[model samples]
Target: MMSDENKVGTYPFVAEPFHVDFMERLTMGVLGNHLLNCAGFHAAERGFGIATLNENHYTWVLSRLAIEMEEMPRAYEKFSVQTWVENVYRLFTDRNFAILNQEGKPIGYARSIWAMISMETRKPADLLTLHGGSITDYVCQKDCPIAKPGRIKVEEQQALDEYKIRYSDIDLNGHVNSVKYIEHILDLFPMEWFRQKTVKRFEVAYVAESYYGDTLSFYRQQISENEFDIEVKKNGQEVVVRSKVIFN
Candidate 1:
């Protein structure tokens, strides 16, 4: 709903080769996630500037993100992307984004949740306080109609694929970057299927740690035309992460 005309300029489109390593691409996905948040803050500042609480107090932090890519963008390819507010609920606000090619076809889309924080205490603040304005007014009718992240019941699936953890997947926080879970999930799909359908909603819970040299087996099954459940296990024994991805 917000416009570049009313705010700062749009994100810069860069043409570069795509990273080949799955883990590296995952990191870029996480970076893209952060970049969209920065864009949202720019929009907020354009409309509300600095929202004063009582004294000097205000900040925004990402609380959660749910996004779906029809296909993962290759390393270093040029792509154009844009983001805007979708809606805000209570203390959480939703942001929507689109990734396009040079020809202007959609490559991927995402929805993320953000929350207001107190600069001093690092605690959450109400949506009414930020005054970023109404999200519905800014929601883009063209791409804003995507379905909500659906819920799926977990069921066991045949073990069909495996991947070994590499040092690059680890982040400074000493854990795999959350987006790596997405890469592992996509690894279960054949290239043909991915080319035909795009992911709709990707939700994950990292259950355990995976170390270098560990082989993780992927288990997955389709629940509908637009949804599936995916899990990664260590050597057929321990579960590392479980996720549900909806496609359209």
Candidate 2:
């Protein structure tokens, strides 16, 4: 087994045309999806084998990711991504990742909290106990920022008008993935919408967990048409997720 100390490597990926948006920069979903792929590659380099998880009975699932982009990579640009394990918690492991241009200039950063879950029971297992040994000694730098999920409020009237979650919106975790939620909101508009418009800022908060069979009500209202407040609710109880999208 290659220890984490000897397991460092950089994964190079090209931003293909399919990965870019109308603005000619990487889409939020593609950026996140590629980051996960980078993490998988790094793990495989450590002899973990990218797709294999825990005796063929478990798999790694992304619980949450707090991603921040200083600037987006344009289409056809070559970027190098680096990932490393920071620490392991009881049910979740902390991983840190960074994206840089060909010249090594930083473009974005991301921190992911993931859980090792049983493929049979579909429930998470303790990270330290799953591999039947303590892997903490292999972790790299212990000093990584803790990116907690955020919180936002949705307007009552907007909640009443534009709120409803459909059956196809849920993911394997039984809740909507953060990136997919953004996609849903973006899909509400046409592709031409971005030619004269661009996302200046975007943020989301995962408030509570939702299950696969649960239908949610989505709510949103334009904040002067260029920005909007959005939320997902179940039975008008706890809000599952809240987000704000700003276009310039």
Candidate 3:
């Protein structure tokens, strides 16, 4: 078995005041970005980071993600995110994370699925043979309490919002940034909704890519008073992504 240090990567962070919301807690979008960054840092240290893969015209893509948090760090609080590879498959892998408070106790957790794909052909690559099969060594048995991303289906509901993808919404891959969707989905509700409650969980699954100039139509279905399922379609036809949000 690999040593614990080899199986996991822990990185620290600070909840800057500017990144917090009116409630004085780190915003969901910022937390999502932090989680992605931790995934990058963890993968890079283990030899399969985007930097290394990009050299060969390959990159990691997020397939699905589910984040559950009891609470986010308050403004000016010091925290840390620890990430580990939970399982490795031929063409995909499962990665997990733990969000620790200032005192090193876990306050939240996340589960994610990723696939390494060739940037040129947009095809997934086999993980079993990468780096001479060294990827298997990083797989750990760490427990990630959050459930995997669930199925989100929104039918022909009236569109709640419409957005045109712009320069700022694009990521390095020339597609709408993943975290940007979360930000946009949250805007569908009124400020009163945010001011009155906290977000307890969020889940997103990428279906297809949405490019610049694509007009995205957002549809929402309320699962309950505090939970909702959202779907984003490009140009009123192609489904690009689906998500779920639950509030306290």
Point to the candidate with the largest lDDT: 3
- The lDDT per prediction is 0.60, 0.68, 0.91
> Candidate 2's C-alpha lDDT?
0.68
lDDT of 1 by residue, 139-241 (tens): 4444644555444445766777877778887754465655676667766667565556655567665566677677888888778777778777887788877
RMSD each, Å = 6.4, 4.6, 1.1
Q: Residue 134, candidate 2: how far off, in angstroms?
A: 4.7
**Could you give candidate 3's per-residue lDDT for residues 1-248 as a string of tens digits?**
77977788999999999999888889888888999999999888888899999898889999998899999999999999999999999998999999999999999999999998998998899999877878889988878888788888887479989999999999987899999998898888888887789889999998999999999999999989999999999999989999999999
lDDT of 3 at 229: 93
Q: Clashing residue pairs, candidate 3? A: none
Among all candidates shown, the one with the greatest TM-score: 3
**Model 1 lowest lDDT segment of ten:** 19-28
TM-score of each: 0.58, 0.71, 0.97
Ranking by lDDT: 3, 2, 1
- Clashes (backbone N, CA, C under 3 Å), per candidate, total 10, 3, 0
Task: Give the Cα error of residue 5 in candidate 2, in Å.
Answer: 6.5
